[model samples]
Target: MSALSLYALFTGRKPPSVKYKYYRKYFIIYAASMSSFAVHTVFICFFYVINIPILSVINVFSVSVWALALRENYYGRHSNAIFLACAEISIHAVLATAYLGWSSGFQFYLWPAACLATINPRLGVRLSSAIGFGCIVLFILLKTVVDDGLYNFDFRKYADFFYVFNGIIAGISLIFGICSIRVINERQEEKLTDLATKDELTNLFNRRYINSYLSEYEPDADLENRPYCIVLGDLDYFKKVNDTLGHYAGDDVLIDVSRYLKQRFRSSDVVCRWGGEEFLFLLKDTSLRQAHDLVEKICRDIPDNIHVCSSQRIRITMSFGIAASTGVSQHEQLIKVADENLYQAKKQGRNCVVSSEITG
Candidate 1:
């Protein structure tokens, strides 16, 4: 299970993600796993009159507390692995020490640890390997010195089988899990990259993302291969609404406009919040004329009515500018030209589209 799960992580899926809707399910898993720990601890207590190995039972309790804390309201990309690792720790602490059955509770030990290793292969390998080795050491020492009949030949026959099982599980998980870390890290890095480039409010790729995306767009072809046009847009009279109503109203307007652009454009295009009341778009494989038409459509379709503090309806408009970069110069040049044209649109009518003439 450990080996298969780790390998599946490499190509099967993009790791587990924590979403708000699944909050209840996460709690359920945590409860079940913690209950497993409690049950294991309880079962072990029956052997020595509820007094057999209280130390491990206590550790299980502590680990359960840690599990609850880690799995609480704190949801992230890697929280599942962390929770599973904690669960494994609790299970093993009880099984290895309390049950003293290396073959029983520890049977599925590799599964949870494997989950950790799968989610973060590199860190999982390094971390779980050390943990695995520690378990082995503890297993050998405790079995030989304490449980081996205090220097007598007792349960000695179980040593080889237990050691072999632990060795194989630990060795395989560490080896393969480490190998897949680079890939997992790459995916995580992509998500972080998306966050940095996307606007939190509207979820449109930001100017920064558009800039970097173009900068690293081509490896062999210089700036000449991008074939992208830029459109700069500014919300006209946006400040008046904020001053007249409130910033909340202005924010709602901005959200509405952003949604308009996102739904109106093609999937290949990127829309960005350039700044306060200003936005930019990267229209892939498009020309200046096409960009102009697109912006014109948005200008004509934008709703003018926005509700106010006293339930009064208000109207709004936007101005846009267009410029094309034929993958020949810096991407910023197109944006600058677009900005100039956007200003021209505002100057012309405050609710129109203007295309900037290419220079040089």
Candidate 2:
């Protein structure tokens, strides 16, 4: 049963562990280790290796204890189960090697265990360092004492069998541990990429992401002949709201506006928080006049009453500037023209839409 479970891990079918999702890889490792122990138990029982079956029984007992620890949320009441399991298994390997002789290749298991312990974030630095140093010291001592009569042992022809089997198990464990680490790193990279591109406040694409998108877009490469427009807008009197009510109120207003903007625009349109109280919209297959008309409608539909704190009722308004591809050669030029029109809207009293095409 244990051997079958171990095989599941090699095939990427991990057992379910809701409390220890991150440590679930170690659960697979534990299953594999238990299976290895079970094999040793069968081998020793068949050949009658003196006192070895007793040690294998103890190792099985250790696996049971670790399994209980995992279930009980032990190991500091968190998913540090892998670290604890690695340390326990490494210690067991050292003891088994000392008793069975280094010829059994049990010491080979220590290397992979130490590697896992050191790399795992769940394992404390001091604990990892101690285990790493202990493994190194034990390895050195084993190498030094192997030639002496005190350490030398022969299991007759069975020695070769034990050595080969142990080596294969150790190699498998190392590969599994390395692959787990790679999976963890890849997940972290994806999370970081999400955080980097998204705005913390409004959950919209930030200026950095939209700018990159615009920079990568090739105007001449539009084989489908789709037109696009840039609509740059900013909240009217947003700074006053921040100063009078508080930044929290300002945040509430931004959140409210962002939600409406998301609902109002097409999914193909890229709406971003350009910075501060400003937002930029990239509308595909839309003209500057259409963009302007859309913004004007959105400005009209904005609720007159927004709750800013429990007692304060605030009305929010936005000014927009539109620019289309027909009048501009590149996004940079379009953005500059749109920004200038945005300035014109601000100058023409707060809640209004201005376009470069109108100004031109």
Candidate 3:
């Protein structure tokens, strides 16, 4: 399947269109909980083999806590799950450090917990940072106050191995938490970009985005000898539709027309919702004649293809005007020319295409 389909499958969200945000907290919590469960299960086995019944039983409780946290996360109780996870980690770290000493690396898990707290959206940044700082203070206290160990076990020989293993696991958890924060930031940036550049109702590029594109667009002089064309289209009697049929029906008509226009244009072309009931097209490497023909066909097809909105068949016509890039250095000049032609088309009569050549 496509990458978008795979993303939807994993995140349980459809592909983003206009304004869309996906909550990744559930995935992060679920993964963290499951990993914690597996790690504690391994610890339970290790402690049992090494004859530490207390630590083994503590690990059993850790596993149960993680399992419950996972279930809570699955049920959409994210704050509860996060609280459970943080509490379990804090308690388990202190207990493990007390039993096996700070050298065993159990206290390292507190670092990731702190990082997680700072990134959680539910907790304000100030409070989360304070919680993270508290974890750090707790870590320092445990290191200074805790004695070598409580139980004088015969597992001193395996101290280095346990230390290395727990250290690696803790490091991985920390890295995962950092990556989660990065992903959340990137997704937020994407949402902001979409909000700024896309039309909400039609999910088409907005006037601002089109203007930016025109400003930034630099033509490759060597490969692109042909001039591009700009076509401005306006829906005929659009105000009447909004006034008579209501704004809701007008929105449906705009959405349907936008979809149709997007499908009719080539992939290289830029289709934008210029403003209310108006669209702008940037046809790369297209002549005025070609643009006019394409737009004329669309104009004819719109009326024949009735748009059904709220059980009402709405037949709408569009007028288009085309202007080709002919020694026009400024993008605004080209758009102005296109707009003049569009006005001429409307004056002559609606549902027709007008071009610079025809007007000249």
Which 10 residues in a row give candidate 2 its minimum summed lDDT?
A: 70-79
Expressed as tens digits, the lDDT of each residue in 159-212 for candidate 2 is 568779888878888898788778878888987987999999999999999989
User: What's the CA RMSD for each of the models?
Assistant: 9.7, 8.3, 7.0
Q: TM-score for candidate 3, please give it.
A: 0.74
Task: Give the Cα RMSD of candidate 1.
Answer: 9.7
Q: Candidate 1, 267: how far from true, in Å?
A: 1.3
Off-target runs (Cα >4 Å) in candidate 2 are: 1-53, 56-84, 87-183, 220-224, 304-313, 358-360
Estimated TM-score per prediction?
Answer: 0.62, 0.61, 0.74
lDDT score for residue 75 of model 2: 25
Q: What is the per-residue lDDT of model 1 for residues 108-135, given as tens digits with 9 covering 90 to 100?
A: 3454454453353335567766665555
* Candidate 2: C-alpha lDDT: 0.71
Ranking 1 against 3 by TM-score, winner: 3
Model 3, 139-242: lDDT tens digits are 89888988576764666787787789878888988888788878888988998999999999999999999998987662452135557788899999898888
